[model samples]
Target: MITPLKAVLVGCGSMSRAWTAAAKDIPYLELTGFVDVVEDAARQRAAEYGSPTAVVSADLENTLDRTRPDIVFDCTVPEAHMPVTLTALHYGCHVLGEKPMADSLENARRMVAAASEAGRLYAVIQNRRYDPNIRRLKAFLDSGEIGPITTVHSDFFIGAHFGGFRDRMEHVLLLDMAIHTFDAARLLTGADPVSVYCKEWNPPGSWYEHGASAVAVFEMTGGIVYTYRGSWCAEGLPTTWESEWRFIGRQGSARWPGDERMQAQVVTESGGFLSTVRDAIIPPLPPGAKTGGHAGIIREFVQCIQAGTQPETICSDNIKSLAMVFAAVESAETGLPVSVSV
Candidate 1:
């Protein structure tokens, strides 16, 4: 019989619903605790997940002590991640937490150091890397049909009017949301950010308190240039949340309209002023590939701990993605290009 790994979920916010739901489907996992600053939130999440008797508490350390969970699922907000992750690692438990890694690079580094000291796994849920289209796109890019990638571009425009903390926060787009896209850029290009120049402004008629719109230019490893133009105040004909992506290479280019289907075109001959073009086939996913998004990342976190391996989004690696976010924010603040580091 399989001995299930007991897991405690920290932070019972709206995002916690997805984590709890995914846990129920993993046979190797057993939900044993739920925690939030507000005990009622924990109780509500526990009952909703059919674990009414689970240890529901307002105190994370106390809950961890009581349950003795083998794993800690951190669904906490950015600022809370540092303490939650440190506490979990201090308990000798593996951790899987939500994206953006931490509120700042210093805190993220502290979390990484704590995990290393504990000798346990700590991975982030950069779930965007697990999408079907992205997997297929990655395969296609590596096939060399595009020759050498020269440039990448993405556009994100959506009027997100959440009248809460986000509307009141500074660097709203870069801090609260742009990290997802930055992380995706890393996954797709298999490159790290070298430096960045960014301009951020709260557009006229914007609903947010600060920095709702921005444009950034990034120099990636391999001399690839990535440009991002985004606005949370854009209302008409908004791009998909995944954002429309275009990757250009010497021989060809491919586009993903932030959707399942992708299209590509390559140069066939050089007779005309512009080289003759032919459609390039975007390949399909490799057989048995798993693109399970949130569930996929959660499963990876558990599987890696059991196998004594590191998951792809482990803190040491994911901090690069987070660095891009901070670098862009710094560039926006200083009005100068800043080196990207973690």
Candidate 2:
């Protein structure tokens, strides 16, 4: 019988539940401990998901020393991601962390360096990449059905009223939410950003303390342009969490209306003065374990650890996604386009 890898979960916040659920389904991973700054939170999570003897601690170092887990699931806040990840790496533990990599690009780069020095796997979970519709969209784009994509557009709107740190954060929309959409755009286009011009402002009657709505234009590799417009304080008719997408290509256009359904329009004839257009039926999505979102990322993390391979969201690659977030924020603040540094 194969021995399961011992794992510890840090941060017993709302997101931890998803990680706990995914951990339960992976046969090779065993949850052995829970740690949080608040001991009660750790104890509560342990009671809910861990074994009777599972270790719980208010201090991370103490918990790491006691449990000595093979893997650490870091569900901590963005600002805490670096410290938690670096500490786990120093202790010879692989890490599967929540998104945004770290609070800032410099910190993210440092975490990547630490992971490299430690020679342990450190992967960030950009769960949106696992959505079936997104996978289909990418496959369709790559299959040349739409030809070479020239531009892409995405719109996200939501009226979130979370009464917490997010409402007061300075770059609330970009930092807390837009990262997912930005990361998804990269996955869909198979391109990294080169530069960005952005504008951000708070609409009248907005609940957020700082900028809560913005529009950004990004120049990506292969001369592709991606534009994003989003608002966290939208009051009515909110867009789906996945956002609506439109991909413009040389021969056709593909659109995702923020759900599983996708549509395309391709030019059938162009030799004459008038071009004929026909609806392009999207191919069926590729099959897998039918596991997706957070579960899919968790499975990949575990599999990569076992196989001694780098996950798709390894810090080195994920940092580029994070850079887009930071660059857009900078452009918004400075009122000028900024070059993206990967």
Error of 2 at 88 (Å): 0.4
Candidate 2: which stretches are off by over 4 Å?
A: 1-3, 271-274, 289-291
- The CA lDDT of each predicted structure is 0.90, 0.90
lDDT of 2 by residue, 197-279 (tens): 99999999999999899999999999999999999999999998999999999998999987888899999999888678899
Model 1 segments more than 4 A misplaced: 1-3
Q: Count clashes in each candidate, considering only residues at least 3 apart in sequence or on different chains.
A: 0, 0
Clash tally for model 2: 0
Give the number of colliding residue pairs in candidate 1.
0
* Candidate no. 1 TM-score: 0.97
Evaluated at residue 328, the lDDT of candidate 2 is: 96
How high is the lDDT of residue 109 in model 2? Answer: 93
